[model samples]
Target: MRRCGPAAYPQPIRRCASCADGDRSLRTVTGIFLALGIGAATGLGLTAASVGRGTGAGVLHIGPWLATPKAGTTEADPYARAVTARLGTLPLALADGLALTAEADDGGQRLDGRCTYRVSGQMPPARFWTLGVVGEDYEPAAPAGQRRAFTSYEVLRQADLPIDVVIAATARPGNWLPSGGAAQIRLILRLYDTPIATTISTSTGLPAITRVACS
Candidate 1:
């Protein structure tokens, strides 16, 4: 019988006392079980930590940039990196509330094929909209197949008319712009230099980006 102590005691060389076996097989089995459990716990802890960090430090989520990941995009939430704010403009410009949102890359889905986003919002009469792509560093994430403008032109319905714009990328081009398989795309909806009558009373809405599968 090996004496195990409170201070750096040597492990017991005892066999299975209940099984009446003098072999060290039971000790080996117990050691293997303990090692597996520890490994599993460590792995789970690291995964949880990664998720927590990603949520706290990354992603843009707000008005113009409200977006979700496409189907089959990621096992985890890829939108964690898309954080939204009324940025790039001043308080006066955003007085009516800056509606902005950004969508991060679904790993590499956008690069493999075409992606479509249906953006709908109830904007002010003087409002305008543009959909642009940006890279991981927040710069323009331009795809190789098409050219894009910095901002969009006038996208209004009519005076006294509610606005609902559907933005998408077309292989043939009806009116939407091209996605170019960008690393990330941000939809910017802005009500230009005017006072909104109903800043607090108006509504804003848009659909998530839907990735079109490659043919």
Candidate 2:
């Protein structure tokens, strides 16, 4: 009988270089696909978020107020159309009215319920105009008893002086409009039967919102 030595044991099977390289290549390909998929998902999420916030193109800025000139017209952009659809609010046609909105105070800080603001300015010629405080949801910030709006006909103004309206969560002494406990607020200035052009111009007069105090 032949004596069995260490060399007689079967040598362990070793992987070929080609097979090892193929495995590494497959892993690299899988990693690339995963990275691409993650990137695509992140991009989609950011786009959706921007649209929801109304960060659309083609916005017109007149002073501190902003409006989409084509919002209520046949030439409305996709973002304007989407906003109108989502809010379900009827935008005034160019011929009937002009609506301007402000979300920040003159200091460039967001309008907050915790702060009092004074909206003061002179409006251009218009048959009628109304200024009101609305919540972030575009609804009346306060109940009717709280006086949410001020109309040109009812507001007190001095000769050749700008009108002033105060907005606060609590009662103020003059021209008070309630904030309705909302953390964030927006101001809407609607001019009805106005001759102002649909396009915003530097001469367009809009109100200035100045922060007075905060709680």
lDDT of 1 by residue, 1-215 (tens): 86666766666687567676534677888999999999999977765664432333222333324322221123224333222221322322333333333443323233322455543334444454444554444454444656443343543445554444333345443334555555345544433442432232213333344444443
TM values, all candidates: 0.39, 0.77
Where does candidate 2 clash, by residue pair?
none
Model 2, which residues run further than 4 Å from truth?
Answer: 1-45, 52-54
Task: Give me the displacement of residue 10 in model 1, in angstroms.
Answer: 26
**lDDT of the structure predicted as candidate 1:** 0.42
How would you encode candidate 2's per-residue C-alpha lDDT over 138-202 as one tens digit per residue?
89998677788999988887877898998998898878889886898889888888878464675
Q: Residue 32: error of model 2 in Å?
A: 8.2
